[model samples]
Target: MNELIRLVYASKAAFRAVPVTQGVEPSVARILMQSRRNNSQVNIGGVLYFGDGYFFQALEGDRKVVNQAYQRIAADPRHREVTILSLKTVPDRLFADWSMKYVPVEQAVRAFVRDRGYLRFEPLQFQEEEAEALIKLFHQQRSGEAPDIEKKSGWFGLRALLPRKFGGSAGR
Candidate 1:
């Protein structure tokens, strides 16, 4: 029997800004493809979103393998900062193994920041449409449901609001 568990792992990861400037998008793509390939061997489904020099990925699989992969990703210098928002285990499968994904934040979402207003997205209050879409995606593993995730906030990194002296900064 294929044992499955659902997880809504919310992660905030910031990458080295230099790589993006150096036209490292190809390398990043390569890394993503390779990660997905390797994951297939271990029965894992990894999906990710990117924007503002950061990445947020959701993965589901065997507990041991998933845990190890998470450790590796956290250690990867390409993305030094990682803040896991929530980790919950569900009774059913949330994703199909061997499935990996990506979404351009802007293209995948509806609302964007305007004039630095905090009125864009709220935290943990995904509207009915978004909530339904998310549950669908989680249950089916592939349903154009994103920018929805962007609607929720509270995604503060412990190291994003302060200076290096404060150990909380997301800028260079």
Candidate 2:
């Protein structure tokens, strides 16, 4: 069976990373390698940003596999206060090639703006359809259920933001 295409986004945890048996950076790298080597993922892809003692990352792949990856990731002594950013269906796989890859924000921001246009990238907000998908993703994340991402809902979701609790006041 062909794996379903999906995307999972998370804005670094608030508190602190989970208990890392290893040190810090080395332990993180080790966990990433382990995940790539022995993970049940279809095509995990995303970025990890380090700022304000928080780590924001997005992982995309098969719904089941991706969800499992999140749980495992949380267990790591490298992240905490996990607040999922978004997880929705995309006609295309964001990163179908790599099992796991780093997203250089400086480079990715430029690319995202270029591909999505200045307005699309700005506070421009999601289109009616995208809003619904994002909302569904948020709900799924909170309830710990598979995203109803593919379905279309209403528009109020555009204002439905993830609680500030997920993001602690740290970064500038």
Question: Highest TM-score: which candidate?
Answer: 1
Clashing pairs in 2: 12-55, 12-56, 17-78, 17-79, 18-77, 18-79, 19-77, 20-77
lDDT of 2 at 84: 50
- After superposition, which runs of candidate 2 have C-alpha atoms over 4 Å from their true positions? 1-7, 11-24, 39-43, 106-172
What local lDDT does model 2 show for residue 137? 36
Q: Where does the lowest 10-residue lDDT sum fall in candidate 1?
A: 146-155
Candidate 1: stretches off by over 4 Å: 1-24, 110-172
RMSD of each: 16.9, 18.2
Each candidate's lDDT (Cα)? Answer: 0.51, 0.45
User: Per-residue lDDT of 1-172 in model 1, one digit per residue for the tens?
Assistant: 4445433333234444344543336646776777767876777775665555555566677666777777877777666546554444646545553356554444333343232233443313333334335434434434343322222342334445666786655566
Please provide, for model 2 over 1-172, each residue's C-alpha lDDT reduced to its tens digit, 9 standing for 90 to 100.
Answer: 5454354433333344445443345544565567556532444654333333444455656677777778777676555555554556666554343344443233444444456555323312334344334323322232211112311232223224434454422232
**After aligning candidate 1 to the native by TM-score, how far in Å is the CA of 172 from where it should be?**
49
